[model samples]
Target: MTNISPIRVTGLSGNFDMEGIIEASMTRDKEKVDKAKQDQQIVKWKQEIYRDIIKETKDIYDKYFERYSKNNIVSKNSYTSLSIKSSDESIVVAKGSAGTNKINYQFAVSQMAEPAKLTIRLNASTPIVQQFPPNASGASSLTIGDVNIPISEQDTTSSIVSKINSLCEDKDIRASYSEMTGELIISRKKTGSSSKLDLKIDGNDNLAQQVANDNGISFTTDGEGKKVATVLGKNLDADITDENGRVIHINKESNSFTIDNVDYNVNSKGNAKLTSITDTEEATKNMKAFVEDYNKLMDKVYGLIVTKKSKDYPPLTDTQKEDMTTDEIEKWEKKAKEGILRNDDELRAFVEDIQSMLFGDVKDIETLRKIGISEAKDYNKKGQISFNEDVFSKAIVEDSDKVYKILAGYSSNSDEKGVFEKLKDIIYEYAGSSDSKFTKKAGIEKSASANANIYSKQIAEQEKNINRLIEKMNDKEKRLYSKYSALEALLNQYSSQMSYFSQGN
Candidate 1:
C-alpha cells in the first residue's frame, strides 16, 4: 500500500480557543450586573436616610406651631365702639285740631343728638291722606277743605315718611320704625353732649297749619322756655337753630340728653368697657392647652422611637422591613434620644423644678428611671432604644411647662446644632457636592490625565487576568480537539490502507 502523509493540522488553534473566549465574556457580564446591583442598594439607603431627617424636623415644627396657635396671639390692628339716644319730645299729633280758623303756623324741631342721615322708602301702598269715603273703584282720595284733591296713584304715607327720613338722616342720625304707634323716630346713633337733628314745616292747609300752631309741637327761640322732650321720666335737651348748627354732646358717663327742647334717656348699663383682662385670661388658657398638647406629642414621639418588642414577636415581612428602613422611623428614634432626650441632667433638673411647682411632688428621679427607659438589649443588632410610654406620659403631665421648655429650647442653641441641623449635615455628606464644578471637569485634560494613570494600572491588571484565563481555556480546548482529530485521522488512514490491501488481493 502506498503511504500518504497525514493531513497537515492547520487552522485548528483558533477552534481550540473558543471555550476561553466564552468564559471571559461570562465573567465580564457578571461583574457589570454586580456593580449595577450595588449602585441600586446605595441609592436606596441614601433615600431612607434623607426621609428620616425630614420627618423628624417636621414633627418638631408642627409641635411649635400648635403651641403658638393655642396661645391666641395673632399678629393685627383696629376697633370701634358705639352708643345711641333718642328725642323725648316725640309725640303723635291727632288728625284734626279744634277751632281751626285757617291759622298759619310753622313747626321747627331740632334733635338733642346729631341725627344720622337716612333714606326711607314707601311701605307698599298706604295712602298719604286719610279719606272719609272710598271711591267707586275701591280707591280712596284726599279732600282738601272746599276742594276735591285727587291723591296721586303712586303717593302713599310710607313714601312721604321715607322722603322726610331721607332729608333728615345724616352721619349721626339713626332711624327706628314704631309699628304699634305708627311713628318714624329719628335719633343719634352715637350721642354726645353736642348732637342734634332739625325739622321744619310751613303750611296754610287747615290740618297742617293746626298741627304746627300747637306750641308743644313747635320749637321756640328761648332755650329755657322751649318745649322739653321727655321719655321714661327723663328730660331730653333740645335747642332749635335757624342755621342748623345745633348738636348735643352726650357726656361719657351720662345716659340722659336733650334735643330741641326734648328729653331722651339711654340705657347703657350692660355695655362693657374695653379691658385687657379677657385677653390675658384667654392667653393663659391657651398657654395651658399648648402645654397639654405638647406633652402628648412628646409622649407619642418618644414611644415610637424607643419602644421595642420581644424576640417572640413574629418576624417582619418584606414590606415591614422596607417600612422600618424609612427615614422617618429611623429619624424619629434618633432625635428622641439624641436631640430632645440629650443633656438629660439639665432637662431633668428643669423638669423636677416644674413638677415641684405644679404638682407639689419632689422626687429625685432621672427621666430614664422615671419612665422605665433603658438602653436597648439588642441596640447593636436593631439600632433602637426602649422606653415605657405610660411612664413617659405621666412625667409629661406632671411637668408640662418643663417639657415644653425642653423641646422648644432643643434647637435654640446655634453653637450646638439641633436634631434637624445635624440631620441636614448628614444629608449633605451623603449627597456629595451640590455644585456642578466637579462634574464639568470630569472628562477634561487634567482629569483625563489623572484617570489615565489610574486606569492604565487597572487595565493592565484586568488584561493580565483575562489573558491568563483565555490562555488556560485555549490550551485545554486545543489538547482535547487535537486528540479527537488525531484519532479520526488515524482511523481514516487505517481504513484506506485496508481497502487498498483488499483490492490488491
Candidate 2:
C-alpha cells in the first residue's frame, strides 16, 4: 500500500511509456495554471510600473511647483524678483527682493545717522574697580537704564565695559572703553534722530559728578544749577527724489529705510540713484529647468502609453527558468514588463488633460506659447514640450505678470487656472489623495501594503485559480497514475502466466 508517485513510476510490461501518457493528458490543466500565473505576473508588473510613474509625477509637483519650493513659478520670485542697484554704492546700496516694488529714484543723503553716545574719559590710572567699591559679594554693581552689570574687584576698565555690554546686549545699548583714548563710550545701538540713551548712576549723582570733576566727562548744568546727563544722538536725515522731479524729506531712527518697495541702506552723504530691474537670470534658469524636468516626465509617462505590449513573453515557469540563464531571464522579463500600461485609457486621458491645459488659453493669456513654451517639432518628440530661454526671459521682462498668471496662478474656474493649477488638478484627479483614482487602484507606492491594490486583488484571485488548477491537475495525475498502474499490473500478470506456460512446455 505504499504511495509512490505515478510520474516517478515506469511501465515494466511490454516497455510501454505510461508516464508520457499521463503528462500528455494533463496538458490542458498545466496550460490553465500557466495562463493564470502569467495573468498574475502581468498585474504585479503593471503595479510596479504605475508606482514608478506616480513617484516621478509627484516629484515634479513637489520640487518645482510647490508654493514653498525655491523654484516655485507662481511665487513673487518669478514675477517680482528684482535686480536693484545703487549708482554710487559707497553712498547708498539698494537691495530689491521678490516682493520689492519697481522703483527708479534718487537718494540725496544729507547726513549719515549716528547713534546716541554718553562718552566719558575715565582716569587712565584708576580703573572702574577702584573708582567704585565692590558690594557685599565683592562685586561692584553699575545700573544703566534698569540694566545692572556686575563688575569684579579685579575687573579692568575693558572687563567692566565687556560686562556692561554683555548685560545690555538686548537693551539696544553698547558700552566700549578705549585703552589708548581712555574714552568710555556708552551709546544707543541704533541710528537716526529718535535713537536715545541714558547713562545714569543709580543713587549716586555725586559719583557722576566726581567722574566729571576728574575730567572724565562733561556735565551740563540746568536752570536750577542742577547737573544734567547729556548724550548726543540723531536720526537719519535724507531726501528722496524721483525722476519726476518730486522731492520728499525723510528723517528716521535707523539708517536702513525702505520706501516704495526699495531698501535704501545709506552710510554716507552723497547722491545715488536706486533702480529696480528684472531678475531675468534667475527666472530664465527656473524656466529652463522647469521645462526640462517637465518634458522628461512627460516623455516617460507618454512613453508608457505608446509602448506596444510585448506578446509571446509571459511569466517564466520554474521549469522554463531552469533552462534560462540569468541574463536570458532578465531579457525575457524586460519584454514581458513592457507596455503594462500601454494605451491605458486613464493615463492617456491624464496626459491629454495636462497637455491641453498647458497649451490652451489661460485667462487673457493665450497659451504657454505666449510665454515661449511650445511643443517639440521633432516627430519623435511629438507630445513633449520645449522652452525657449531667450523668449521666456524676454517675456518675463516685458510682461512678467502675464507670464506669472499663465504659469502659476490659481482660479476657481477651470479655464482660468494657470499651468501649475491646471497640471496639479489633472495629477490630483488620478493620484492626489488617498481616495484618488490611482491610489485606490494601486494603493500608495512603497507602503507596507502597496501591492494590496485592486490589481493585487485580481492577482490574488488569479492565484486562487492557479492553486485550484494545480490541485485539480494533481488529483487527475493521481487518478491517471492509478489507472496506468493497474494496467501495468494486469499486463505483468499475463506475461508471468505466459512464462509459466512456456516453462511447463
Candidate 3:
C-alpha cells in the first residue's frame, strides 16, 4: 500500500482566521521573550557604563595620584634654583645644583681614557684550515691574556674569534674578526690608567707571529728601562689638572663628573664657570599640570554623583520596536542608556569621600588655600580647583617644603593625610580590581570586553525557555486545525443524509 500525506485544511473547515487566533493566544509568551531580550540589552548597557567609569578612574590614579605621591615635590622645587653656565662649553659643560656655590674653575685635560685594542691583520686568500698552525702536540692552542683556547685545523676565523671571546670572557676582554678589515681585534672592557690588555702566544705556533706581523703591535723597553707593550688602542686614561695644579684622573667610560654637588660635562680642555639662580619655571609647570589633572578627575566625580536619571525611558521590547520607526528606536535606546549610573548613592558617597580630602587641614601647612590652591567659588564648578600664580610663587619661593608635606603626607587621622593618599584609597575601593564595588554590584568581570557573564547566562536560559514555549504553541495550533477539520467533515455528511431522506418523500 502507498503511504499518503495528510492534507491541511484552512478557512474551508471554519469561517475563522485560525493563524490570527493562534498569534493572539501566544502573545503573552512572546511578550516574555521580548522582555527577557530587553532586560539583557539593559544589563549590557549598564556593564559598559560601569567599565568606562572604572577605566577613567584608574587612568587618573596612575597619571596624577601615583606620580605626585612618590615624587619629592620639594626637590623639584629646589631643582629650579640651580643653574650652570660654561665659559667654554666646547671644552667643558657644567650643570650646577642648589649646593653649588657661584665660582669659576680652570681645568686642563691631557688625555681621555680608552679601551686597549689590538687588531691583527689576516691574508684574505688564506685557507681556513691553515688559520691555526699545529703545535708540538698537533692540536693548536691560542692563549689570550691568561686563558688558553683550543683550536682545530677545521676551525674558521669566525669560529676562532668565537672561541677566543667565550674562553677569555672572564678576563674582561672581547675578541672579534672584522670582515671589512680582515683583522681580529681584542679589546679590554674597562678603560683607565690602571686597565691593561696583555696577549702573548704560549706555544711555538706560527699563528701568533703571523698575528703580530699583521698588526703593528710590538713590545719594547721604555726610556725608564721597563718593558712596555703598545697596542692599536687610544685614549685609555682621562687626565685633568685644575688651575691649582691638583690632578684628577678618571676612566674614559663617562665624560661627566660631580664635584662639591656640581656636575660637569667634559667636552675638551678649558675653563668653565657655574652659577646657581632661582628658576621658578619648573615648579610652576608641575603645579599647573597637577591642577589640570585634579580638575579633570573632580569633574568626572561630579558627573558620577549629580547626573539625573531618565525615568521615562525603559529598554525597548522586540514588538515595541516592530511598531516604531528606526529613528524612534534609536531615540528610545539613547534615553534608556542615559542614566545607567545616575544618582547612585554609593558612587556619590565615594565621590564625597575623595572630595573631602581637598579641604586641607594639615598641621603646619594648614590648608591648600594657603599654598594658592583653592576650590572654585561657583557651585556649578563641582569642587574644581583654581590656582593663584602670585600667591603660589611667593609660597614656593619662601617655603616649598611645607607645601610638599601638606600634599604628600597621609596619616590615619584625616587631619594629617593629604589628597594623594585619600584619593588612592577611594579609587582602590571602587575601581581597583575584580573586588571593586563597581565590578561586584554590576556583576562585571575584569576583561577586555564589557559582556557581563551573569546576565549573559540568565539571557541564554530565557532564550531556551522561550524557544521551547514557541514550539509548544505551534504544536497546539496544528492540533486545533485537525480538531476543526474533523467537525466540518461530520457536519457535511449529516447534511447529505438529510437531503436523501427529503427526496424519498
Candidate 4:
C-alpha cells in the first residue's frame, strides 16, 4: 500500500531482483494516489478562495452599510450628524434632538435664575476663635433652614465651612471660605426663587456669632421686635414668543428648559434667534463616500469574475514541491489560484445581482442615477460607480428623505427596501453560514466541522480511496513476494539434487 519504491532482495536465485520487479509493477497504483492528492488539493484551494471572498464581502457590508458603524450611510444622522447653534452662545444656547430641524426665534430673557448667596468675609487661614469668639457659650446650635449644626471651640474657618456644607442635602445649601477673596460664601445648591437660605439662632448664640457675627444677618430684630434671618433666591423669569407670535411668561425653578423637543438655556438678559437646519453639504459628502465604497466592492467582485486564469499552472503535487523553494512554490501557486473564480456561476450571479440592485430604483422613489451616481464610463471598470456631488447635493437639499429612501431608510414594506438593504440580502444569500449557498457547498472556516462541507466530504472520500488503493497495492506486492519465495525454494532444491548427481559421476 505504501508508495515508497521497494528494495531489491536476493534469494537462492540471486540473479533475480524480485522486490525491484514488484516496484515496477506498482507504477499505475502510485499515479492513482498522486492524482487523487492533486484533485483534493485543487478542491481545498477553491474552498479557501471562496472563504476569502466571503471575508471581503462581509467587510464591505460592515464598513458603509452596517448599522453599528459610526459613519454608516444607512442612517443619515451617522454620516451627516445633527447640529444646532444659537445666534449668541453666551446669551443663550440651544440643543435639539433627532428629527427636530427648526427652532424658530423662541425666547427673550428678563432675568437669569440666581442661587441664594450669603457672603461672610473671613480668611480661610484664620482660626474661628480669633475671627468670632463664643457668645457666652456653654452649648450652642445654629439652625440654617431646617438643618442644625453644632458649634465647636476647636473650629477653624475651613472646618466650620465643612460643618455647614455637610448639611447641603437637607437645605440645598453649601459653604466655602476663600483665602484670596477672604469671603466665607454660603449658597443654595439649587437655583430659582423656590431655593432659599434662612438662619435661626435658638439656644446659645455662639454658633450664630461664628457665622453672621455682628453683621445683623442672623436673628435680626423684626418690626414686632422679633428676630428673623431670611434670604431668597431670584427666579428665572423670561418672555418667550411662542410659534403663534403670542408672548408667554416663563417663571420656572430652573434656567434650562425644553420646548417642542428643543432644549434652551437662559444665559443672561439677552435674546438669541435660534434656528436649526440640516447640513445638506454634509449629507451629500456622506452619500458620496457611500458610493465610493460601493464602487470599490463592485470592482473587487468584478475582478474575480473577469480575470483570466493561467492554464499552465494548476495545484502542485507533493513530488513537484520537493524541487521548489518556499518562495518559488508560493509564486507558482499565486498563478495557479489566479482567476480560479472566473466565470464561476455562483460568484458571477452574485455580481450581476449586485449591479442590478445598484442601478435599480427603490420603491419608485429613488435610484443610484437619480441620486447623482452612475456606472463607470469605461466598460473595463465593470460595475464600478462614479459620483456627481452637485446633483446629489441639490437633490438632497430639495428632498433628502427621497435620497435616504434610496440608500437606507426604515419602512414596514420589506419589498420596498433601499439599495443597501437589497444588496446586503444578496450577500447574505452567499456568505451567510446558515444553509447559505457557499456554506452548504464549501463550508466556512469557522463552521462546526470541515467535513460538514460537500468539498470536504469529497476529500474525505478521496482519503478513503487512497487508503484502499494503498492496501490493495500492498496485498499485490505481498502475493508477488510469496510467489517468488516459493520459486526460490524450488530452485534451491533442484540445485542441491544436481550437485548430488555430479558428485556420483
Best by lDDT: 2
Model 1 earns a TM-score of: 0.23
Q: Number of the top candidate by TM-score? A: 2
Error of 2 at 480 (Å): 2.2
lDDT of 1 at 180: 56
> Cα deviation of 381 in candidate 1 (Å)?
9.3
- Report lDDT (Cα) of residue 75, candidate 2: 67
Give, for candidate 4, the lowest lDDT window spanning 10 residues: 1-10
Q: Tell me the tens digit of each residue's lDDT in model 4 across 128-246.
A: 65555344444444567777777676887777789988865566788888888787787897898877788665533444555556344565754643234777788888887756788
Better model by lDDT: candidate 2 vs candidate 3: 2
Candidate 2 per-residue lDDT, tens place, 354-434, comes to 766655445433466667877677745535777787788777777666777777777889777776777777777777666
Against the reference, the lDDT scores of all candidates come to 0.35, 0.73, 0.62, 0.70
Task: Name the lDDT of candidate 1.
Answer: 0.35
Candidate with more favorable, higher lDDT: 1 or 3: 3
RMSD (Cα, Å) for all candidates, in order, is 24.1, 10.6, 8.8, 12.1
Error of 3 at 280 (Å): 2.2
**Against the hidden reference, what TM-scores do the models get?**
0.23, 0.61, 0.59, 0.57
**Which residue pairs collide, candidate 2?**
192-234, 192-235, 192-236, 193-234, 193-235
Q: Write the per-residue lDDT of candidate 1 for residues 1-505, one digit (tens) a residue.
A: 3353323332234234444554564565445444443333333332233234334323433433333432221100000011112222232111111111111111222232332222222233355444212344454432211123344556555554454345435444435565655544545555444444343221223333343343234433334222222111122233222223443333332345333222234332222111111112222333344434434433443443344533333322233456675775555434323332233332233333333322232331343346333333542222123445454444444543333232222345533432223322332332223221211112122333323332234444555665666566567556756665675566666666665665665
Model 1 vs truth, CA RMSD: 24.1
Clashing pairs in 4: 1-470, 1-474
- Which pairs clash in model 3? 91-268, 113-235, 113-236, 113-237, 113-238, 114-235, 114-236
